[model samples]
Target: MAIEWKGIFPAFTTKFTAADELDLPLFGKNLQAQIAAGIDGVILGGSLGEASVITTAEKETLTKYAVEQVAGKIPVVMNIAEGATAEAIRQAKLAAAWGAKGLMLLPPMRYKSDERETAEYFKAVAASTELPIMIYNNPVDYKVEVTLAIFDQLQAYSNIQAVKESTRDVSNVTRMISRFGDRFSLLCGVDTLAMEEMILGANGWVGGLVCAFPAETVAIYKLTKAGRIAEALAIYRWFLPLLELDLHPKLVQYIKLAEQQAGLGSELVRAPRLALVGEERTRILKVIDSAIATRPVLPDYLSL
Candidate 1:
């Protein structure tokens, strides 16, 4: 199950029971929805998946479960957001053993590392596993920017194959293409920027809102790639408001709430992350409801 490094890859949310436990039944339903909608891959335990609060064992459980559930229809990628180099390596190996086909590697958590250190951390993790890696280059949230020079250093590792490009500057897509010439597959990590990045030649989208709006998300990606810009833009314009929810700090809860509205998941989150309340919940629900009310009938994008 080699990764194609192209198409819609959902940064899937981890479903939880009201008791704050893994809700595998709901999680499986969402995974099935994404698969049926034609996503290229599924990434578990990512930022939107609430990786920080999910224990290591729980991450492994998710990897094993996703691998079994997707069952080779698409790749299952586990996210590695460890604070320690050794722990990152350990998790990478465990993910591979758990049947994950790829990994989404984030910079060392908590401590912001310099260029050399960031490159070294990535190199160490890449070397620790045979699994293909997609570097999560999100300086806006992670604080450590994986600059081009760092990527130049990383080019030696063939398994460090792709990037979840979340720098928020759409120009970076052109910069990467101009510099690396596809040395690394670039996937738009920001949901709101997915259409822009894809048009700029990003290979795929690691979308957060796709957990709830899989069909619209996949249609936008397929439509963009098929040279149907106008059609893609139509849905993207309709999708913009819902997609903006991915940028919030409470993205896990926000997305899960969207999933609830979509009848795909629940809003239960782990400790330190309470469910949305007061004006926030009401406001977000309005956006979700609005989108649902006007949800477009998608074209047959798969035929493209």
Candidate 2:
């Protein structure tokens, strides 16, 4: 099946032992749990998984492992963006060659700083592969905006199928949908604005916090899709703290800790990216406790 980029796609975490090498066993297990929980797809090597710290070999291996583990149960989208065009192409080619269902494209780290430059950059990367690509409009961290002009131009490419809208601006999401008119599937990259964006017109969500609590994320999607707006809002209310955490500079550490506390994955981030400790660890644990307390109760899992 051609993977649809139109629903909850968990930007899953990278697991590690206390010693911190790639924990493929834990990684595969977590992927399985998310799939079984009813996620539309599994996103490997995304910010949620600390893709920036990992080497190309690690990304390649994880992409291969995740794709194989999903085994057509769900779409497996790998974050193939790099600071350099050559590296992005390398990751995308490797993931495509390995049978990943899709690629999540983040702009080059150099930051186009403007629309024409951004358009040119995306065009360059889009020309590199035939795999369906989801443009990651992560202006929150990237400082790069996916302006309407840029989206209109990029949509001309058949492969630029979806976008991870990281902007919190509602007008931006509404404007894009109005302009493109289903030409692009806008996935919520910012957790806080997900409900609002969906209310406006977003088709899906892709973010760091959802990986630690897949069932809750899936529940929100199911409820919303079924037209149960009140129920979805209640679930969304409980997820607010998590939405706030995504705004923090220490987001990766906090997200990994939540996964660890949930018995999902390790908070073991690679070096240069230090371990969460002192005040940061305490802060994250409190958030995890709250998420566990308010997280939706689901079948086949522990009660919230």
Candidate 3:
């Protein structure tokens, strides 16, 4: 089936056992929760999923695992973030071979390439694979902004179907809609600005917090799009604190912590990234606890 890049697509964090091994069963459980929550799709091996620390072989395994677990229920898009164009092409091919329905391709990792270099890198990968690609434009964390001019150069690739707009500028959503029209689907990648972008023109949300609160994420999208703005605003206001967690440098840890609180997954992270501790842990918990203590019950209107 052709995957629709037009709703909530959670960039899931990789689940690890205490020994730091891939916990495929735990991963499946979280994915099942996403399916039940009515998320539009799933993205594995993105930055939130510890892509830098994961091996290409592991990602291929994850792509296969997600495909099997989802069993064609929803599209599974694998993320490709490599330092070289050839490596990116190889990752894209590996994902396609392993049954991924789509690919979220990042710019050449490690080095900060100029716009021309970045466009070339994307073109090379797109030319090598038939899978639909969501070009991730996260300059804040990735140091690469796929600017409008760069996108203008890439619009010819029909396989380059979408843009994960995490430039942190809400106006970028409007700019893309104005320039590309229906040519490129815009996915809001910043959790904080998700509502704003969606209200403007984003076709979907490539989310982080959805891993923890999938239902609420989907509800927000559905409600807003259904012209139930007041209802969506209430949930968005309640969700704002947790959504802010996705914007942090240690978002993986924060999100894993949230996942544990929600009984969705473990907080165990790979080496070099430890569980939160000290005042940091206490500080984050204060916000989470308060939100939980007063968490709003979803109305029947959101049952969809």
Candidate 4:
């Protein structure tokens, strides 16, 4: 019930060049701005950062660059999800080499795997690195779910220090905390469920929309932590439409567009990932606009 971690840890968006290379300079600037805005840390290349489409080498390169830029000002957690134990291990080692402070690992998924396979995968990856690791449980999109027993089996892993529970089930978040208590930190993954998880006693949040609105996300976490329920709800309800976008398949596209509109990052995602356009674009804007109208005032970067 007592933990020092507070405020937002924005799942940072990646900046891309016109040709779609990672724009690390812009990324560094964004990270610095978030820290200045009182964010807790930066989550590099999570769902918001579109880690799935990027290459293995690209993940390593981006992870390396982010660590250097942040320069230990705050924590930097690298996403290390892949299809196999070998690849995850390789990436974890590289992230350690790259100076990452923590590792975020989603369940191993390329196909359906049984309990043994899932447990072993996490065990292997956990064995590979000493950096504090957070289990990224995003079953809806990844098509894999780790049961509570899996967490029970892995409690022996000291480095497996946190969890980004994206199951979108507040009960599961509460259940895990009830079972494990402070054994593992609970990180709310779905932005729509942030306040609920925080209210129920989650450790922190690993957010996607923070790519577009780090200050607002940080404010949400801070208010929740301070027990200012009405104030936090005011902000959360205002941003409900944007958080709803988290459920869509083209979330990264919309998130990047939000960043572009805010002048924080570019919308140029890698190939096989197209930008939101036409009717889709119009609908998303309407959602964002309605949320902005509900809010008292838009944050400076999100204005115009």
Leading candidate by TM-score: 1
Q: What TM-score do all the candidates reach, one by one? A: 0.99, 0.93, 0.97, 0.92
Pitting candidate 1 against candidate 4, the one with the higher TM-score is 1
Residue 251 local lDDT, model 3: 96
Q: What residue runs in model 4 are displaced by over 4 Å at the alpha carbon?
A: 1-7, 290-304
**Candidate 2 backbone overlaps, count:** 0
**Per-residue lDDT tens digits of candidate 4, residues 5-84?**
33577787767898778787888777877877677667776767777777767777878777777676777788877888
lDDT of 2 at 40: 85
lDDT of 3 by residue, 82-114 (tens): 898888888888888899989998898899999
Cα lDDT of model 1 by residue, 129-193, tens digit? 89999999999998999999999999999999999999999999999999999899999999999
| Model 2 residue 123 CA deviation in Å | 1.3
lDDT of 2 at 81: 62
Better by lDDT, candidate 4 or 1: 1
For every candidate in turn, the CA RMSD to the true structure comes to 0.8, 2.6, 1.2, 3.7
Superposed by TM-score, candidate 1 places the C-alpha of residue 167 at a distance from the truth, in angstroms, of: 0.4
- Model 2, span 61-92: residue lDDT tens: 88888877888789888887677777777777
Global lDDT of each candidate: 0.92, 0.80, 0.90, 0.78
